[model samples]
Target: MDTELLKTFLEVSRTRHFGRAAEALYLTQSAVSFRIRQLENQLGVNLFTRHRNNIRLTTAGERLLPYAENLMSIWLTAKKEVSHTSQHNELTIGASSSLWECMLSEWLVALYQQHKDLQFEARISQRKSLVKQLHERQLDLLITTESPKMDEFSSQLLGHFDLALFSAAQKTTKSELKYLRLEWGPDFQQHETGLISNDGVPVLTTSSAQIAYKLLQQLNGCSFLPVEWAKKREGIYLVPDSTTLSRPLYAIWLQNSDKQSTIKELFKTPLIAQ
Candidate 1:
């Protein structure tokens, strides 16, 4: 089995869109389609549901996903074990959207200055998938809010961010108990009396914190987001501090890779959480 094809398959599974996957892999749509067909023909199993513009994994594809991941890990491990000396260091890291603050830029500059031979790739994504990649040895580091378990992976408490209610600064009507906001989880949202709904159900509903900020700029309604994410809220107060919410964040990496000091150096930097 080709590792590249398997990688493409997993990428498609993560994104759930073919054109998007093609763009991500730098392959033409036809090329990606042909590779899937080739893999299916070689394995004597169909792997994807075909639609003109939509694609989904077939039952066989789902069954084979885990094995494909294991196979890729085995190959990478073999290559590392056989390497006679440290020739080059290539590191890939994943981060949740929250960590793309000013710190990311600073980290890259420091890393390059320290390790001229370093080649780095980074992506922003959801928590579960990033953890899976870290466990599989596909990613060197992961920064996220939730904890993931792995024997070779170590977790470090990074910092915290407060999730607060926000609204259009100009539109806030002084109604404390009757406003709508994004719901993260019950720990932050439980027993709160207010109007809350998805951002798009009413054709104006939005789930984006950026959009919430914009709405707050337009005075739409209050929304939920990282407290430090506010700029205009300097004067716009939210529903009393009683309803303010915050969650802890974590930075994780494979324990076995700490021998590479550049990767370790990134974690040493204070990550601004909000």
Candidate 2:
């Protein structure tokens, strides 16, 4: 089976527009359509339902998605293994933008102190991108707030951190405060729904804790941040009567990976604390 065909199919499924997918793949629209047709001919099924301005995967296409993703992941991993050089042992770690600022930055320092010879790469990306990199074996480890649900992956709890609302102004009421919403994950979102008023809208919504912190200081607004981060800044006080939120951090890695021993060793060190 041609990997390019599968890639094209996946791209089309993602974009839901042949023209956009073609542009992304650097292929002409006709070429993209031809590849999809070839794939359909090979599978003997209609993979997509086409309409005037919309396209969607059929039942057969939906069933094939996971298998195609796994196949591509395996292919990519094989390619990387065959092309690996022996100059130095390389490891790539990925995390969300906020995780990089809050914990990964310190963890990287500790890792290098312990293993000076190891070649390390850190990727700061969105959660979805990090998961994709993990699936493709492009990343050796992932630091995240939530554990991935894939059976092929394993996660260890690093530690929990407290998230509390901080503000530049003192003794402000919830109604008077201009809340800056931080994207911690699903659990935070659920917790926020209860705490935040239905009529209240955030002054700013951001995924980066660093950005939220800076913005709160500049705008004199309020935001929930890691207590560790809040302690570092001056004139930032916890909001009155606000509940402190705790979130678990996890170190995720693929099961039976080549870096399993290294991952286990790293976890054993006192890099992250409760």
Candidate 3:
């Protein structure tokens, strides 16, 4: 089957409008329509039900979506693998934005320095998206705080990092300080729950530590941040009587991955000074 047809179908399905899909794909509206028709004809099913101003996928289209996505991911992976010459081996590593900011950036630098022959692709995404891509073989390795429960994947503890509550206010009581929450992971959430019983609702909650850090700098508030990050910045002092949190990080990849040996070797490179 032509992959272009699948690609076109995905775009139309996403946008729910042929004209918008055409604009996104840089094709004429009629061309996009033709591709969809070709795909439907080839499959011998009406993939979409068109209405006046609404478009939605049919049951068959819904069934085909996952397969199309898997196929595209596989095709991209194959292209990357086949294009690699003797001089370089390609790797795609994925992690959450918070992980990238807190640790993976430094690890990646060490990785590249140690393995000069390797070409790298870094994908910073949310946990759900990263896990989905890992399952689809779109990523070679994923660094995360949560372990994948699936049997097809293997996980290893990368290291632990310390985070502490920091406040911009020179002197403020717990009730007086504004709270900004940065989500570390489930483990951190549980740890936080045990420490603070009546901290009140946070002024802001986010997944990115950088966002929380910037907000703390701009506004007189308190939030949990990496020990190193807090120490480096001025005017943000550790909150008195706040418990320091240690969070474990993990590296996960497919058990039967083709890059298993290389991934294992890369783990030998120290991510953080223990």
Candidate 4:
């Protein structure tokens, strides 16, 4: 099957409009339509149903979407691997911004220093996007607090980190402090709801620790932050009588990943300290 046809099909599927797909692909609208027709003819199925201002995928298209994504990802990876002339081993790692902020950044630096022959590409995104990339085989490894419960994936507990309430105010009660909620994960949310009560909405809610930290400096707000990070920064004091939460970090990757040995060897030395 021609990869170009698959690519065009994917673009049309994404935009739900042949004209938009053509514009995005830098092709004429007729060319985009022809590619889709070619792909559908080869597959012996109608990939999409066309209506006035409404374009929706057929049953076959829905089934082919995941396969198409996986194939594209695999082809891209293969192209890079074949084109690279270097002897160094390359791995793509994905993680949420918070995970990168809390631990992966320091760990990655140490990794590069220790393993000079290894090269890494980091993709920092939201958890959902990271997981989707992992599923499509764009990421060799993913570092996240929540483990994916899927048969094709395997997860190992990397370590745990402590999150404690930190405030810029020298002295203040939990109720008096403007609460800045840093969304760690569902477990953290449940744990926090049980321990703290701010009466209503939080002053700020964010997934980025950096944003929360910046706001903490400017506002008299308290947010749960990594213990080590909170302790290092000046003017960020630990709130008295606030409950500390311990969250587990996990390294997730495909069960049948070709880099299984390499991934295992990389984790032999603990990435994050418990």
Candidate 5:
């Protein structure tokens, strides 16, 4: 089997779209189509159920995915075992939106300085997407705001990432606190007004918290931001009655990676560090 074909297969499986996978792989859409055709011809199985706008994995593809992924992981591990120079010198880390926003740069720097001759790639992704990338042997580590649920993953909870509500520099007096409700995912929609007492005036709504923060800086409204981010700013006043929301950070790694496990032990970072 061609190892390069496996890369294409995994990419197509990930994106479920030839065009997008091709863009990521830096190949043309037609080239991606050709690679898939070559893979299907070699394996004597159709991997995708084609549709106009979407592609789903077939039963064979579903069964083959784990086997193919494990095969790749084993190859990577074996390569790591015998080699003297570290290949993880070029490492990629994945993070979700809020993690990227409030995540400590020191965490990345600490991880980076551990290895010699290392290059880093910072990927912005959703939690599920990050998990998939990690499983595919594509990412070195994943930094997330959510705790891990699966048996295969080990999650370490770092200290709280504090967030607070902030209003414009000019708008004072808590008697009238107009708000901009900033919500990103389905999980955080409940805490709109938060502990801060708002005057029932919803200025705007957005799906991205960063956008809300920017808008709050420009307009006459308030939004919640990571306390670190808020503290760095001089103009904005922290809403008087606002409560701090604490979101814990998690460092996640693959269960089967012998290399990462050894590194984790050496770092002396516990699974539940305060």
Candidate 6:
């Protein structure tokens, strides 16, 4: 099967329009249509249900979505490995911005001390993109707060980190404190509504913990931050009686990836133990 066909199918499914998918893939609309037709012919089933102004996946398309993603990911990984000519081991690690801000930098430094010959590539991406890269074997390991839903991926509990409310101001009054909302995860979202109450919505909201940390300092607003980050910086005082949220971090990787042994070795190091 041509990977191009699957690629085109995925783009179309994502955009829900052939023309849009063509534009994104730098192909002509007619070429995109032909690819879909070729795929449908090979599969002997219609993947999409066409409409006057909209398009949706059929039951078969829904089932094929995950398979197509996995297939492409494996193919890309194989191509990468075959093209490698370096003598040293190469590993690509991806993590959310929050995780990077929290401990990945330290871990990388510790990893290099033990394995000086290894080459490392670091990527800061959101959870969804990280999952896609892992599935495609583009990333060797992922350190994130959320676990992958796919069965082909395995996750290990790294550790639990505490998030404490920090304020630049001396007073701990909720009404007087300007709030900066930080995107920890779904669990934090549900837990926060009841934990802290503000007179109005946050003056600023950000998904990146680093951004929130800086903004909290500059804007003099309060936000929940990793205990490790909060402790490093001076002038940021913990809010009195504010609830501390515990978030679990996970190291995730593809189950049968070639880098599994390397990942295990890295995990065994003191870097992850911290």
* Clashes by residue pair, model 5: none
| Candidate 3 local lDDT, 75-170, one digit each (tens) | 886776566434247888998777788778888999989999888899988788888888877788999888879999999998888888887766
For model 3, state the Cα shift of residue 79 in Å: 4.8
lDDT of 6: 0.83
lDDT by residue for model 5 (11-98), tens? 9999999999999999999998898889889889999999976899999899889988877777775564445255544556787564
Worst 10 residues of 3 by lDDT: 79-88
lDDT per residue for candidate 2 within 62-134, as digits (tens), equals 9999998888888887777665545227888888778788777888898889888787889888887888888
Which stretches of model 4 miss by more than 4 angstroms? 17-20, 26-30, 40-88, 126-138, 147-156, 198-200, 217-220, 254-258, 268-270
Quantify how close model 3 is to the true structure by its C-alpha RMSD in Å. Answer: 2.7
Residue pairs in clash, model 4: none
Error of 3 at 214 (Å): 0.5
Q: What is the lDDT of residue 248 in candidate 2?
A: 87
In angstroms, how far off is 173's CA in candidate 5?
Answer: 6.4
User: Model-by-model lDDT, in order?
Assistant: 0.64, 0.84, 0.83, 0.84, 0.69, 0.83
What residue runs in model 1 are displaced by over 4 Å at the alpha carbon? 1-88, 101-117, 170-208, 217-219, 232-242, 258-260
What is the per-residue lDDT of model 1 for residues 101-149, given as tens digits with 9 covering 90 to 100?
Answer: 4235556677677667677777766667778777765677787666666
- Models 1 onward score TM values of 0.60, 0.71, 0.86, 0.74, 0.60, 0.70
On TM-score, the stronger of 3 and 5 is 3
- Could you tell me which residue pairs clash in candidate 1? 166-223, 167-216, 168-216, 168-219, 171-219, 180-195, 199-205, 199-206, 200-205
Better of 1 and 2 by lDDT: 2
lDDT of 3: 0.83
lDDT of 1: 0.64
Clashes (N, CA, C under 3 Å) per candidate = 9, 0, 0, 0, 0, 1
Greater TM-score among 4 and 6 belongs to 4
At residue 226, candidate 2 shows an lDDT of 85
lDDT of 5: 0.69
